[model samples]
Target chain A: MRGITITLASLLILTLISVVFANYAHGYMVFGILILAALKFIGISFCFMELKKAHSFWKVGLLLFLVLFMISVLFLAK
Target chain B: MESKILNHKNIYYPPGGILIWIIIFLELITFGIALIVMVFYGQKELEIFHTSRLQLNTTIGTINTLFLITSGYFMARSVSYLRKGQKEKSSLFLKLTMLGGLFFLGLKTIEYYFKIEAGLTVGHNTFFTFYWMLTLFHVIHVIVGLVILTSVLVGLRKNPSKVAIEDVEASAAFWHMCDLIWLLLFPVIYLLF
Candidate 1:
């Protein structure tokens, strides 16, 4: 519980910082920060969703899903 | 049987079972495609996308993201406590999780009302189209998630032991997916250009 709380707090603080930065960012910086957001999404799934303790199938499956999602979102954003 | 074999060792089994994992993966793919398509369309009208994003309330989106994430934390703890056989503590945490969802829904209603009053309906423009469709769909998911959690709460009172572990884990998994999707949706629909 402590670990999860700390992780959530850290992610929130980092997300706020990233959001503020992304708001004003231009060029590649925008997508870069969005990628940070994607990472946070994956991190939350791993921790909060208990995917860390889940089977290898799920661990691998989620990783692939998010990777493809991030790639598609970023690649198609232009 | 294959089912028994799969569920036996539990080494290769997902928490909520293979069915929910399949559902989660399928849902992720579906939303990923939808969002990617929306962004692809958005690029053609960058001017409208940028301007429309400004009308969105970033603070509210941020708040909801925090709420969902906190709720997710509570949910994970609830499952952990339940597995530990702490029924009362688990029930309390689950209720907290539901409260967070209610807060999110109330704020989202206000945000929608503000948008609708401002004439930002789906047909108003392309960007609003994407905004309304994605977030409304997500809102439905949240509602369903709440229903699932409510069922869990009720079942806990009747007989926590009688409730299948898969059922609770499935609800927990669905709730986590809501948080995950909102985290993805918030920046794209509310913040990004």
Candidate 2:
């Protein structure tokens, strides 16, 4: 429960940061938003999806997937 | 032998089982490709995409994200309570999760209505095309997820002890997939371009 609460709070804060600083971030806005999103994605996967209790294989696989996804998005956006 | 099988399952299968995870990965890949393609097109049709994207209601998008994330938190709580043998608490959390989903659908419907009224249909432009296609597909997933959750809730109410944790986890996994997809979709569509 505490874990989820903290995860939720972190996600909300990240979201607000993405929204609030979007204009100020200028050219780097997309990168910042995607980074925040990647963090939220990890939080949900580990806490809400209970990947923390799962085997190392699944955890590592998901992290790899996220990294690949981020690289692709950032590359394409650039 | 049974203990060995259980141990193997624990190591290989996640909370929802390997099958659901496979489906989740496939879905994520599909959406990922679509998003990348959308971004590629956005780069080419920068003007059309930017102007059309501004038609979107960022406030509504942000609210829906909150709804889905809170719903996901409720679903995680539901599964946690069920594991602790607290059926009532679990059921309550399940209902709250469903409520959050309903709120999302409601807001999305309103947003869609306004878009259609403003002639921002799928045929409107390249951006609207991707917007309608990706978001509508996601809406379908959320609807299916709600149905799965409803079934799990029914099972819990009918025979609490008989309700399997694996089943609940499977449903929760599906629900979180919706949240995950939206997490990717919202920023790209509404904020990025």
Best by TM-score: 2
lDDT of 1 by residue, B1-193 (tens): 0112235125546776677778777877877788888889888998998899889998998888888888988998998888777889999999999999999999999999999999999998999998999999999999999999999999998877677666788899999988888877887787667
After superposing candidate 2 on the true structure, give the runs of residues whose Cα lies further than 4 Å from its correct spot: B1-10
| Candidate 2, residue B96: lDDT | 100
What lDDT score belongs to each candidate, Candidate 1 first? 0.83, 0.88
TM-score of candidate 2 on Cα atoms, chains taken together: 0.95
DockQ per candidate: 0.59, 0.65
Local accuracy of candidate 2 as per-residue lDDT tens digits, A15-75: 8787776656787888898899899899998899988878888888888888888888889
User: What TM value does the first chain of each candidate achieve?
Assistant: 0.82, 0.90
Clashing pairs in 1: none
> What's the true lDDT of residue B187 in model 1?
74
- Per residue, candidate 2 scores C-alpha lDDT tens digits across B1-193 of 0011233236667878888888988998899889989999999999998899888998899899999999999999998888778889999999999999999999999999999999899999999999999999999999999999999989888877677787788899999999999998988999887
